[model samples]
Target chain A: MTTYFNEMYDSGKVRPPYARLEDWTRSMPAELREMKQAEAEALFRRIGITFAVYGEGGDPDRLIPFDMFPRVFTSGEWARLERGIKQRARALNAFLVDVYGRGEIVRAGRIPGRLVYRNAAYEKAVVGFVPSKGVYSHVVGIDLVRTGADEFFVLEDNCRTPSGVSYMLENREIMMRMFPDLFRGNRIEPVDSYPEKLRRTLASVAPTKCERDPTIVILTPGHFNSAYYEHSFLADLMGVELVEGADLFVEGEYVFMRTTEGPKRVDVIYRRVDDDYIDPLCFRPDSMLGIPGLMDVYRSGGVSICSAPGAGVADDKAVYTYVPEMIRFYLGEEPLLKNVPTWQCSKTDDCKYVLENLHELVVKEVHGSGGYGMLVGPKSTKAEIEAYRARVEADPGNYIAQPTLALSTTPTFVDEGIAPRHVDLRPYCLVGERVELVPGGLTRVALTEGSLVVNSSQGGGVKDTWVLAE
Target chain B: MILTVDHVTLYRYDRPVRGLVQSHRLMPSTCTGQRVLNWAVTVTDGLAGGAFRDGAGDWIQGWSVPGPVSEVAVTVRGTVETTDQAGVLRGHRELTPPDCYLQSTPSTRSDLALAELAATVAGHDDVLDAAHRLSGLVSEAIVYTPGATAATTTASEALALGKGVCQDHSHALLAVARQAGLPARYVSGYLLVEGDGAAEGQEAAHAWAEIWVRGLGWVGFDPANRCCPDDRYIRLGSGLDAQDAAPIRGTARGTGFEKLDVTVAVQAVQQ
Candidate 1:
């Protein structure tokens, strides 16, 4: 009776798009599969692609699990997803622009004014100034989950610096290296052009002060950061310099990277540093990882910050409820993808219902990321649920609850052959001169037998998502 | 009444520091009672960045001076013509709603002392009357002492000690006002005290608290001076706390023993 919608199959019959993958999976032996898994791990380690696990006592840099099995999608399915992602990104950027200036959406009574104005994520510093090209979130990573063959829902909107594109690119690289024949036979679209596209996107949003070809640099919080590897990798791939806070300085209405050849004017900074630590003068004064006058220059239009400060408000979980309204309000189009039915604990009725059915609903902190502050209802025990309920009751406004979504499963290669595991996709939609995205995105697999959490920090693995060419 | 101000702040370090970046909120308030005749804020050897009028309706400008320069002088000179309207500020263009100020900051967080202070003026029905009562009560509670409290002192700390400066007065007022269900903020501006009074040497640039009245919008109250702001007060900027509304916020690169010398002269100009 426990039927999970597997992307590759429909009642034991192989879907047309996944037939090739099925044949390949059957042809490979158990020993070869084991060897390939080790090979993938070795490749990942050698390439130095690792994520930092915070608050853990052990090694900080843990390699995200890599599965040899790739999740495939037909061109038709991909085309719809591409449209949805682009639509969502455009709407999100527009929302950021509006919230910072005038807040027409708030005035229109579509979204509650308190949500946009009162949210802690809403940075008051960046208000009233629009960035170059009016683009707020230049790079949008939209997290999507599938329920059925045609049912996809947006799980979250990461308008700020969304990491893990390196995994996407790296997964494909290893896949192509390991199974050269599978790629040659299958007309799969290449995702290798992402870095070039990212570079172009950053270049397109250069500030007005640039007299020459704009200098674009990646602003990293330094090597100790969890996504430092991704930062360096992306910078290398884009042919741009990866800079720390100390490596850059703001001078005379512009940001400059300190080079041996004196200071070079930096027009665009693809900053990986969070909003609070981007500028010490404007935000947290004690932040060591921030340029002193970076925000001053940015507000003055000397340099453009990709995914501008305060764009986080648009992606805040409380604001996520209005994304569909945003799409309609700004784009004048119906939302391409549906959002999961979420109950904001800020609402008294929603909070009451969540308390009544604590074990049946998954509750998450509104501002939490990386899957740290969450309670998966079904998987939790009585003691855990009781503790979480008390916490939620203590501060209901900080939490949001949703039904345990029957997340679609994919045939993933585990130790005991192939088994269905939950998966999610984070498509990096680039917004600059125009909204653009690579065909396929990073597909995170839960790896565990019945786990629904696909976050890499939570024992989840990544797989190559193949979008078949027409 | 036209008041001319000369504010010169010098920072001298024991060792050569790297550099300094500063944002100044020195522009005169745009309310009806106060009009700027002339104003200029300059830094020695500093490169001018971009200038912007912030959401709080304050003119802010950025400046940066390069490294290895030991001494930096930030000089602010201005002349403003002020017409007294009984401390009523009119024609200011702040976009933020009053409710935003209700959100208490770390420095203005209310405690047992603040709750008791708010209780002193609890019976007043009108918010404006209650705000005035709260302001007067704060002045009575915390005796004005020049060096009694540090800049990091919160309202509760000052209330417990029973003595503080203008910054502490503003913090205490903000905490108590918020506790009394009135939206309040810390305001930084130049208060022109005519003649050689106690506010002569280097303390003309003052801090106050503004409470949002239901019918009257934002009304300034200076608990340190035991009076609401009049034409003599040239409001520059306001925020949830004193630090956010700092007239000059900066980050000096490099570390050393920094000796700061400040001189602010606010004299009434007879024109």
Candidate 2:
């Protein structure tokens, strides 16, 4: 296959934005070059840029693989992507509100309720509860992959507790030193404003009579979580207290945080914990990460929590199919973005088609994340396809299928030299009074040869996304 | 006079496990003509210590203590009543034609405020007039849809969209009352129903509002049923809102989702 870098460089479509990087790569001495990889790995360990591999009884932490070469987007290309992301987020938010509140599209018989509600993330607890600003999934990270220079398709939506924005921020810090020349001359937009935007969104929902300077807190499950670095990073950036569940309480319809002085009123909480772990009273009674009466405090208008509980109902894969219709129904505006064609197994006709086309399409479990219970069409064994077919037939609502397009690839520096690897972009958005996109996002690369899965859990690596100036 | 009340709640998951539980109790006492309020709470969950936040942005750390059983329970009972209202007798009067004291009439600020809340306005012309306006507005604004909201829904969110569940209705009324400068609090207790009920399910632990009235004292309002809390109402606890008076509040040690089922039964006796 023609390498992405060679094609772009040879065609002169755009002079390599980081032409100076070529010198940085070539100038290193042979012995020093071999040692650079080891030095990079050591730095990653020292900085604690690692992920917890769940279910690994011992030695759970593994260093996140970082690519030496960064993927760059020109100012023109980034502008289009920015707009596309905003459009996609707005549409998805509308879809969540509609599905939970009115079911207009479901009543119209376009999407099936059985498919939407059956997903584990779909919360019956939030059916009629509207958020303060009429917004759900305020922070969205839409994963998109490119097949060619300008062609892109959305892979999935990560609206519920999306991790890795921290990775994006941390990756940039590391990249600046590793490839200083490439970053300095490229004019990449800075992603440092994300924490500030996040803080503002949480504060926007404070109760009416709260103190003028409302105390904001970031609620986390503590240091054991895989995304603990992101939690601490965000807390530091926002200049707010990082609180565990035990550090908070609900009294007289108000939420208070245990501080050095005493119980202080907490106006807004940017809760990083999942819904089931947020309030033991409302969700899992066994959850020690949640406050007993926290949900009641929120209900009573004594406090505000970001993204709100039960917002996950819309991000269910089945709900993704109805988003375009929801955007039109709620906003009266056409969706500027398009979704990858999906086959809903709940529909008999679609399921029939999917079963017949199993060899050419990707099959995914509606509720699974982190690349679990997924089948890559072209790579699947015949027996595996037959087993998946049986699973789909037994519980049609649990599955969805789509054509496996060749996800776009970028030139990544490998041991053998630069090679083509599938990559995807997940830009983070902070929706307060308006939507704010962090300049750069997490660009995930499928590290294995010809592998399409780019989830970090699936042996994927990451590159720093550069939104460059024109 | 001062009095203290204690509240206790229990929860059991499908699985067996010990957990942490937190609660706030309001206890009331009377001496001469004054009433005093006292509160106390205990939280026990996890190996890590627990803490509580007060109105002043302070933390009161909780020590780790061993608990018994897989099912978790939290209890909060406190007492609070106006000191000046102590020993005051409230006599019951029958209606020849019961005058509506709760109704907001002439569309005055008081009337508007009354109408804005979800309360009974059947007797007092003033409150009745306002009740008509508020109920009409709510009915028009919110389209009845199941699974749109829960008991914890906020008022502003619901009103912005002009729709919500029972909790949203109560919250909207509460917000309007607070905006109108009325000292109002959320009340969670039980509603006594006669015989069998509708198919929507049995009346569970219900929520309403209690607004402080100058002469009448704290009066009950049922926004969900658009009536004054009457014979069917069994008052539990009063707080700034629902969070303060939740029947059950606690924490557990699991990492997955939990299913909760609540049942409330209230029986009325006549002498």
Give per-model CA RMSD: 1.9, 15.2
* Candidate with the greatest lDDT versus the true structure: 1
lDDT of 2 by residue, A1-470 (tens): 42332312436443465465556667766566557557777877887778886755556578778886677777877788788788778777777766666667667777665555444566544555556676678788888877666677777887877889888887888777665666666677888778888888777766654768889998999999988877888888889999999898765556778889988989888889999888766566568798776765665456777777767877778788777776677667776666789998978999999999998899998888888888887888999989888888899878999988777666776777667688888888776568778778999988887888898888899988887766
Per-residue lDDT of candidate 1, residues A1-470 (tens digit): 34678998888899989999888988999998999889889988899888877776587767888988889899999999999999999999999888888889998999997788778778888878888889999889999999899999999999999999999999999999999999988999999999999998989998877767989999999888889999999999999999999999877787889999999989999999999998878888889998988888888789989879999999899899889999999999999999989999999999999999988888999999889889998899999999999999999999998888888888898777898899999999999998899999999999888898998888899999999999
Task: Please give the range of 10 consecutive residues that has the lowest summed lDDT in model 1 chain A.
Answer: A52-61
C-alpha DockQ of every model: 0.66, 0.06
Model 1 / residue B104 / CA error / Å = 2.7
Residue B240, candidate 2: Cα error in Å is: 27
**TM-score to true structure, per model:** 0.97, 0.66
In order, candidate lDDTs are 0.88, 0.64
Model 1 chain B: ten consecutive residues of lowest lDDT: B193-202
lDDT score at residue B118, model 1, on the 0-100 scale: 94
User: CAPRI band of model 1?
Assistant: medium
The alpha-carbon deviation from the true structure for residue B49 of candidate 1, after best TM-score superposition, in angstroms, is 1.5
